[model samples]
Target: MGGFELTLDTLRDLAEGAAVLGTGGGGDPYVGRLLVEQQLRAGRAVRIIGVDELPDDALVLPCALMGAPTVFHEKLPGAAGIVTALRTLEDRLGRRAAATMPIECGGFNSMIPLVLGAETGLPVVDADGMGRAFPELQMETFAVMGVPGSPMSIASDHGDAGIIDAVDNRRMEMLARAVTVQMGGSAYICDYPMDAREVRRTAVPGTLTLAARIGATLRQARDDHRDPFAALTAMLADTIYSHGVVLFRGKVADIERRTVAGFARGRVRLTAMDDPGDQMEIVFQNEHLVARRNGQPAAIVPDLICTLNSETGAPVTTEALTYGQRLTVYAISTPRIMRSPEALACFGPAGFGLDDPYVPVEQLVGGP
Candidate 1:
């Protein structure tokens, strides 16, 4: 084991890093960050285990909060939420949760386990289920690899708990979302329990580490007066990935949203500052799924669609996006894990009502 501790410094770094990579989906870092920091102050240890070191027999679980990405502002679940989920799930499985993995690479997902780790005794893995947030829970790597979403468990702030078992991963996500709404718009969940064998095949390897790197680079670049986006572009280029320019920089001009299909389906309009006549609309189901430039298809699923602040350029979560908020639309290639034929089937064009061709972000960006 390289290390068996989650330090304050590391937690701060992770929080900042996660926020930058949230890709306009995961909840903000400040809320989850403060929660986890408080727990650490109380003296807790979160561990990290290399994916290869996980025992084939050991059971791995991904921990996270589930619900409308919007609920955080009205009724904060408070810091105790994550520990409640972790402990409850540990008991349900009747086995000690060997280690913890983030469900996604974004702010809240990475921070949830850290907060719980201080209250409970589980260590956070240097990994996550999804490299980035997907609108649906089933969009995680676990689902892409056919890992069952249950037997899973969730806990709400009201002390209500539920054990979920579904026939398929998508059904499980739908069931869980409905239950979360009833629990006041959010529920803490511990799911995707699988043996190390399955974990090795499905989970994005070293995603937490990757997030940390991206996070650190952004900060360092900013200090050097180097463009953060340009630095990100270079990093992706080094990896043979492609990225697009500032699509439109302005404030949200309008929003049309509804709670349907057990998910938040909405459209947010961004008024352009550079091009006064141009406007962009972002359509999402939990994560940003599509982008429209002046009512025409700009990018759709299978390609990574994300939005960020005009100046900060950090992620702008679906929940946080609203009218009068300055922003910039962006695109990047999907993680290789998500580009597979099987992956495209679930989260690609058809999944999001995208009628146009699902071009790779690289191709759309005019390639490397």
Candidate 2:
């Protein structure tokens, strides 16, 4: 498919879909939708182009918001933060960025680049570093494929800006996390500078389009009085995320949340309203990592653990969960590229301090 122009209607759909893919991380997409909507109203037309359409020599910069999602609820990013970071990165690189891509294709990070593209007059590539949102900077296909995360630029709504040149992606994440904490716990970043060829090879293709489609499908399902959960599973089954299953349907029983080391660290307990004896637990560090049913492992990180409001079919972020809220939890498979042993080592349950081994969501769910 050719490039598509983004409109307010589609932006709403993209935001909803992206939140589903966020897996309880990446902050809320509503904030991002509002930012992009403002740009659209100001007459900026952002184009989403397929990776295949990009010229091989084009320079593409992956962009995102970093730090604790909880911070974003209190301190909204400046409208110019992403654009400033993009310009700063281009200046540091000594060349203009031909386009901007999302560092991840879930939640606010997914839409930030579109707003940046509208403001900077750059096309937004319809691809991203992660097929879904990940909690850390290094949990990306670009970093896994040997792309450097720096020289990176970060800008805060507080008018602070800084450049970081780390020896590697891990160091980049560490240094950037320090800077974000100093920036009041949230900042925008432009990193993973790559040519079109590298982007095509390293990025998860068509995730932007997938987000939009997922949003549209959910809307249609609701309008037609069909099961939104069923619609979601069918849609995901057709994509690289070939399996999606509801792990549990219940009400929140308890929560233990705290911000530690610049990340939202916590776990939530759920008990089935219909079967009170059936219980599940989910652990998270910015994103949901491991899910267990009746204390047995049901899903692990590197796979998605998505929570949705049982009634409205809307995604529920980690910070948004509360006791007594009825919810449905779903688990989806990560992309094949992200499930490799090397990639698993970087984002698996063990990476988050859990002792369980990595397992694909499909295996746990017994197929799509």
Candidate 3:
């Protein structure tokens, strides 16, 4: 599909797909769904355009909610906050955005751009920086491809806002994160303002549509009484992701999570539903970073590690994971663009303070 209008009929699919891509991070997709639905009900429109459809020099500003997902559950970002930040960035650059795009294809971040599109009457790009979510602001394909995150703007629902101009993307993350904390743990941001030419080369292509497909696939499978996991893996085999595997099926045994450093940092332990001795542990910083099963790495960063409800095939975000929840943890390989040397250096295991080297999820999991 080249482009399409987002209507109330398709909004749920996009939200569900985004939550799966979130990989147990990003904010709550259900909350995001409600937010976007609210806009559609208000008679606004969200038009999504594919990467190839973008004009070469048209300005495309990426926007998202940056903060702890746990905090987001208690507070919702207002449409005005997002618009305020986008306008701030636009004012600094002296260019009105031809389109808005998602920084990541996860939960609230994915839908926030759609909300912006509906609110401002600008088309939302059907692509994103990280094909999935990552905690740090600089951990995006845009930054890896040399797009600076500066001239970034942050705004809160209460009307507070500021722009950050930093020498490097990392410094930009630090400064913006500090501002996010002051704004009460969560805030909306517009950053990496680049023309469509840069976006076509740097962003993960067609992820918004891909996310919608994922959501639709799960829904269809469930409606048909088919195995949603099997259906999901089969569908992913045909995408840029290439491979998907159900790494483990278990119940949440323990969870130790905390909001720290402007991120939801923690680890969750799960025990096999049938085998008490078989266990797995997944760690995260706003996003699932790694998964280890029986003391061996099952999935590592740069790949997608996600948790889904065992029965409904619905994704469960990190903030919502709780003890005794039955879940099917799965991993999908990221596209080659995300595995380049520079990309790995930005979001690889080392980036999250892990000693293990980056490993493709298929190699680690013995995929279907």
Candidate 4:
């Protein structure tokens, strides 16, 4: 992404790619994509940099949208929610942001920072706290490296702002989630506050650039009538599960939901496309937790479970699941950063209230 001049086309490509990497979580990037497009249209300047370019003492934080994916469908967040959080965080930290970074690789969070950076003239860092998406604040590369998750600043659309300082990331997830739910199911979080030194050591390098590249690749492939699934597979180590249906064709057969101590937890079941005799189940705790065929687990926690529109192969979020429609269920292994004990400890099945064995997804999938 060298010395690139910002443009709407570029942001659109980035958003599309982020959607692919979102792996069925991070909410839809459509609104965020449009939001960034508007900023680019307004002639904003945005710079993207590799984390390697960061100063040793810099305070780099990863921030993103957080809330019930359900509410996201009903009340589209006022697009400025992210910038609001950045401003609120700066006010409390008593410092200007040196660089802005994405908390995860999903479309919305990854692209939102570009617009914020454009407006603030802060360079968007190339790396992210997570190379892929995870359900909770505690389940990031920063956590794997032992950087604390709190002293995080959260901002809401109602002009409400506060600092989240917790005993740990789990506590932070719980506390921030409580406040965010009260604030209307979602808010922005600036967390994993780290100096440039830690950022260099822990963060996934070139994730932002990688996101743009992925977006571009997908777009190019589609235009050329190439297989997007093949391109996606080459881009990351993930599995693709699909039929031929588009986004609007899927049906939600069953949903089992529960709120355990503030975290939204549940599973959704869908009957097969052509045969009701077959079935699929998607488990989630804030994000897609697991997927299964018949009674055997097909995809599990720590493994990416992205539901793609069958025709397009784009990622799908839990919030988007519906009844009886055909859909592609992808299962990608967790990024290396998320495979660590600490990362898994926070988001593994146990964290989501399951007693299943904690096994690396690769181990479960065998090879290729």
Candidate 5:
């Protein structure tokens, strides 16, 4: 298949699938779905091209919304913000962006670039830096592969915009976070400019298609009166992820959420509905980092820890968690690229202030 024009129906599927990949972070896909739906209704075309099909010299820009996901719930951005950021970056680099791609394939970031592409008349490359969502900008495959994250542009819905030329990816994230907070907790950014060759090497291939396929699989399972979770696991195991399973099934008992240092920091406690004494806890700094059951680590970062509504099989975002909600937690292995020593150092449990050693989700779950 070459590429296809994005429609409202496909966007809804992408949003649902992205929320599952988001690992309880990357902002709300519902908001993203609404934004992209608006663009489609306005007669704009958003096309998704496979990354391998991009010209070797094509200029690709990765764009996303940055900051606390909670903030986005209250403050919606004007489409102009993403346009401004992309245009600002293009002007700064003295070259036009040939295509746009998502910085991450999970949550709102997966769909945000589609909106930009539709608005800017640029096709979106069907790939992303993180096959899943990550809290920090530096924790992407692009950064892990030595791609510079500088010469970036950030813009707010209020017509404020700024450019950053950082020495490194970490500095880029630090600087951007400050600006994001000042912009009322969220902003749009275009960063990690690269040629098609670099994109092919650093990005997770076909993630946009993967997200869509996942959504379609789940929808079909639900419609056929089959077990959606079983179908989801089968689909994930057939992909680069290679492993997927429900780690816990319970009802939320307590939740502690706070905006700390410009990030949504929180923990969720769940009690097993079948066994009240059995409990599971998930910790997060935007994206889920660790999950423990009865104080024993069940899953750790670099691997995906996702929450789904038990009854509906719908993905749930961290900021949307509420007490007494029935949910099932799934643990899927990270892409092989993300499990490398270098990549782990950047986004593992230690990176999130957890002293736990990195463990594969399959190992923790006693094989898939």
Candidate 6:
């Protein structure tokens, strides 16, 4: 299929779908949905193109928000920040951007590129660095596949901006995080500046479109009075994320979230509704990292650990999670590219400082 236009009607699906793929991070997409809506309302258009559609030499600028997700709920970002960040990066590179793409297939991050596209009339590529949202900048397929994340530019809503040309990808994350903290805990960033050739080689393809498809499936299931979780897993069956499983169904027993050192660090405990003694715990640093079911590893990164509303099947971001809420937690296996040694070494359990080794969710659950 070719590229499609993002109409107002479709924005809802894209936002909701991206949230599902966000894996309990990426901030809330609702703020981004409003931003995109405002843009579309003003008669601007946001077009999405597949990676194959990009010219080999096309300069693609990938953008995202960096900092604690919880801070974003209060210090909201605006279009000007991203636009400014893009221009600042282009000025540093001495070339104009041919197009914009997301650094990750996250709720707000996915939509931010669309905001840039709508503002600049540049087509947004339908791919991203990470197939799912990650907490750190270096935890990306692009980084693992040899893309330098330096020459990065960050901007705040107040118009403050800075560029960091780090020596390495990990350094880039460190320096960027420091700046994001100074920018009031959250900031928009343009990084991983690369040509379309590198993008096609390193990026996770079709993530934006895939997110829209997932959103539509969940909406249809709910409208038809079908089981949305079943529908969601069924739809994911044919995708790159070929395996998915409902790990636990319970109420939030306890939550401890805090903004520390530019990241949202926390853990949540869940008690099984039928058997209170049976419990699950998930630890996160900006994004959900590892989930332990009764003190055993149920899912670990680079696989996705997502939380959803038990009754509505809507995704719940880590910032929005509250105590006593009934939620369904599920895990989706990462694509092969993300499971390779290089990829795992970048975002595996050890990368997040966890003791559990990298284990595919499919293996842990037996199968999808």
Q: All models: lDDT?
A: 0.72, 0.89, 0.90, 0.70, 0.90, 0.91
- lDDT of candidate 5? 0.90
| Residue-level error in angstroms, candidate 5, position 170 | 0.7
For model 1, how does the per-residue alpha-carbon lDDT over 148-246 read when each residue is reduced to its tens digit? 878888888877776888888888888998888788888889888887788888887766666666666667777787877777667666442245455
Query: Candidate 5, clashing residue pairs?
Result: none
Measured with C-alpha atoms, the lDDT of residue 172 in candidate 6 is 92
TM-score of each: 0.90, 0.98, 0.98, 0.87, 0.98, 0.98
Candidate 5 per-residue C-alpha lDDT over 1-368 given as tens digits, one digit per residue, 9 for 90 to 100: 38998988788889999998999998888878888898899999999998777789999999999988888888986689999999999999999999999999999899889889889899999989998998899988999999999999999998888899999999999999999988889999999999999998998888998899889888888889888889988998778988988999999999999998778899999999989999999999888989999999999999999999887688888999999999999888888989899888888877777899998988888754
Runs of candidate 6 exceeding 4 Å displacement = none
Model 6 / residue 123 / CA error / Å: 0.6
Candidate 1 — number of clashing residue pairs? 2
Model 1, residue 85: what's the lDDT? 73
C-alpha lDDT (0 to 100) for residue 211 of candidate 6:
90
Model 1, position 139: C-alpha lDDT score:
77
Considering summed lDDT, which 10 consecutive residues are worst modelled in model 5?
359-368
Tens-digit lDDT track of model 6 for 285-368: 888999999999999988999999998789998888899999999898888889889998899888888889988888898864
Task: Give the runs in model 5 whose Cα sits over 4 Å from its true position.
Answer: none
Candidate 1 lowest-lDDT run of ten: 238-247
Q: Model 5 misses residue 294 by how many Å?
A: 1.1
Q: Output the lDDT of residue 111, model 1.
A: 80
Model 2, 266-324: lDDT tens digits are 99999999898999999988888889999888999888899998876789999899999
RMSD of 5: 1.0
lDDT of 4 at 92: 72
lDDT (C-alpha) at residue 6 in model 6: 92
Clashing pairs in 6: none
